[model samples]
Target: MSQIISGLGGQSLYGGLNGINSSSAIISNTQFNNPLESTVDYSALIRVLVTILQQLLSQSSDNTTRPTPTVADTSNNSQPFNRSNNFNTASNNNLLSAASNQNSEDDRNIDFNILSATQRDQLGMTPRERAILHLWGRQVISAGKQDGGIYTNVLGADGTGTNWANKAEVELVKELRAAEKQQFGGDTGIFLDQLYFNLVKEKTGVDMSTRYANRPVHFSSGAVSIITDINLLHQRTGLTEFEQGALRLFGHDPLINGKFDGSVLDYTISNNNALDGSRNSSGNPIDKVVRQLLNEDIQDDGQRNGSSLMKSVITILDRLYSSN
Candidate 1:
């Protein structure tokens, strides 16, 4: 039995159990002889075998629970967790930011001060009043440029052969004529005021007629001259003296030495040209004239000094008469 144990490398097993000196020696010395005749310590052998089994079980448990080391994947195929979701989130954020910025820019571009009723009140004018002045100015300028009879009546001798109107007025008249041609009713008698009001409503969403129930309506008459019509307009509208004068300048040719030489329209256009060229310089007569007309403070600098309403009117005039 000892020879059989030696052949099975039992010595090596005993060498592995180094700390159990007594068990190692006993295990090494135990011999299994013939079962019927030999005296064998089965209990000592049982104790050594139990100790070996316990140590083997402990080693197996340690191996089973031990954590394994891992290396990070650096291959091209590797991607972050939730990679697609993360990319979509970032892209949506960028688009939202861009849209917000664009909306802010658009808001800045629109002049809210001009559109707001409360702001217009601060300038001592209602929106309807402002719209009336704008309409009258535009019409007078437009009528001043018409050919033949209408031109002669509106601007007098000054309208004889001169093309004193701006490009916008010319284009406006062209468009109006085109629209008139397409009308179902024939020859509606040159309703420029209607066209002007229609444009104002379309652009601003404010119907001038609704705002001022008694607003003027344009009508053609051979009995009344343009001057008589304008005087009646001032009386009916209760316009200030300055407002009346401004309207007259557009509708009438100014008399020099009791004879008409040049209209206020002529001087206004010339002065506007000078003002445009020398915007930073001072002492243009038209600037002083406008300030006086609006009863605004006059400054030496070329920069405009007026109430908000005054500034707005001047800005409209500038745009209407500008060569560029």
Candidate 2:
């Protein structure tokens, strides 16, 4: 894996991915590494994303591209992350322009939210970004009820959060922590901190730093109901070969995408029997998901035509590498 990343080191992955013929197959770019020989062609995976990205960017002028406007242009496309401290009053309205970027990056918004008031605002995340942070944290650990009403009085709000959509997925974990040994019906297992591992990681992108996001959630029931999507428990209780390999590289397990009964998280989150796949909505593998999608680049290589996403990746990777 290291060798693959190393070979592509300083190389613009977005360029290569974006360069794939827009008319060609998306799966062609997303091909994977060899499980047996560590020989994988990331191009195939890139293709899948390229198709999506192409579709997205192509819609810049086509209002009919989808039912709604491209998220960045949509005033309602708020990110699910709620790390209040880092959000700037400015990011709420405008998206960082993509002209500074090359090509591959014009895909998703990479901005991140503030950690807190006193926290040095590092990444400068945008609004939709804030939502992803919130989404990831909610799915990973149980969520407490949030008094989202604070946003209700705002200029615009969309789709009402139904009971299932509004309830916390990991609410059970919190309840279990306070439960007695006998309340569990068996030996006590799992720690509270462990429950929030990816939650914190997703929020801050610091790889499970001791510092935690301090947002408080207020439940609608007046009591935060603790319920593990029974389906999530079943899938995570055992690991798959692909999942195990991902965990080894990324340091965490992925979430269940469908229930044993074969239901999607959309249904479950809104009150079905399945857990959403552990991945962020972007469909990136859960474990390897990047935290701050920093919106810049460092490689001056003329060989590269930096796309928006490429710039974000390069800038962030460079920043992290240099900080060390």
TM-score of each: 0.25, 0.18
How well does model 1 score by local distance difference test? 0.35
Tens digit of per-residue lDDT, candidate 1, span 1-324? 554433333333433433445555565586556687757778867776677667655555655655553111211112222212122222322222222232221111112222334432332333443433343453443333111123233333442323633333334434444464476222222445455345445434546434433333233221123332334544644443444444434222211111111222222322322211113122222334444633432243333322323333334434322311
Best by TM-score: 1
Across 18-65, the per-residue lDDT of candidate 2 in tens digits comes to: 343432443334335656764445575565456655654554445344
10 residues in a row with least lDDT, candidate 1: 253-262
Give stretches of model 2 more than 4 Å off.
1-194, 198-294, 297-324
The alpha-carbon deviation from the true structure for residue 169 of candidate 1, after best TM-score superposition, in angstroms, is 4.8
